[model samples]
Target: MSATFAGPITRSPHPASSASDRIHRLDIRDLDELSPDTTESHGEEGLTMRNQKEIRETSIRSARKLNIRELRALLGRCGMSVSDYDIEYVAALHGADGQPAYGASPHDGCGRPLPGNRGRPLILLSDLALADLETAVVTIYHEIAHHRSYRSVGHAGTEAAAERYGWRMYSEFVRQSA
Candidate 1:
């Protein structure tokens, strides 16, 4: 049960423009900003966990944890292939060190298509969403919408688009249980 604070994610001069799938999307993770001093136990599995700056906090708690592999499969069912993006479980989403203006809302979750990387885009999901499968699914949909729109919230019709896309997916997968 040890907790530590860290820094922020630095953006390179230019984001990667690969040919593969053009990785890009939002990744919602658990809540780390809410629990900064909280401690978690990993026993002997060596599972690392935390929620702070410029760092990615990983957790082994599967209570409702969303599996990345499963996430891709779910996306397939949703009529999208996010193979171009990389999704990871995180406690909080951080902005570029000194670039708060370009930072994202540490709320539900966030998706980024350009973070200066060579591989697929990065999606920072809230690890807290792991507490519920439906929440995770819906969150994915929301972020997927952002990816599809190629823009995070704050733009015109961006948030609406994410909501529509996200709920549609949720209804298709959860409500309908398809």
Candidate 2:
């Protein structure tokens, strides 16, 4: 004798909710914007006001429009891969010593080195700072400037040479590769 198999059927719940069961849905951004506190911390790790400001200032044609994946891919295309180790090293070399201390800045995406002896090395980057692809390249190039300096000398420079050299190297690399 042959036996027939039966499968469990799933059903959707009723579409309507009772007066006592009202529910609300919201995106993180909407929640953030609605909160009284302008800055929100995610557990111990979160973006800071200073970091947000830095991204804002360097914002050129494509600022606050780059995603992290796009930034990573762009760096890979440029032959520079930034891993956790490299990120920490670069952040530290740029003056962000270690995990941020109490009263210290939270995010360190300023494109500039952390303040000497009083900053963190995590260097957080959030969607608010980089929303899509083009800005990722710009942000990565800025970070590369610091990394190259760390590799050559002990740390990244803060003088006019730093910015000049960083932009110069970035331009040269792009032109030659293209």
Best-performing candidate as measured by lDDT: 1
- lDDT for residue 89 in candidate 2, whole number 0-100: 15
Query: How do the residues 1-178 of candidate 1 rate in per-residue lDDT, one tens digit apiece?
Result: 1112233222222222223312243333211111222232212221122122322234235465667678778766655556665666665442223211111212112223533143554555665445456556555655555444434332212333344445555555543334
Candidate 1 lDDT at 67 equals: 71
Worst 10 residues of 2 by lDDT: 1-10
lDDT agreement with native, every candidate: 0.40, 0.32
lDDT of 2 by residue, 79-177 (tens): 545443122212211112222111112223332334323342333343432544432333343444334333344333222222233234345335434
CA shift of 145, model 2, Å = 3.4
Give per-model TM-scores: 0.44, 0.34
Once superposed on the true structure, which residue ranges of model 1 sit more than 4 Å away at CA? 1-64, 74-81, 94-112, 115-118, 151-157, 175-177
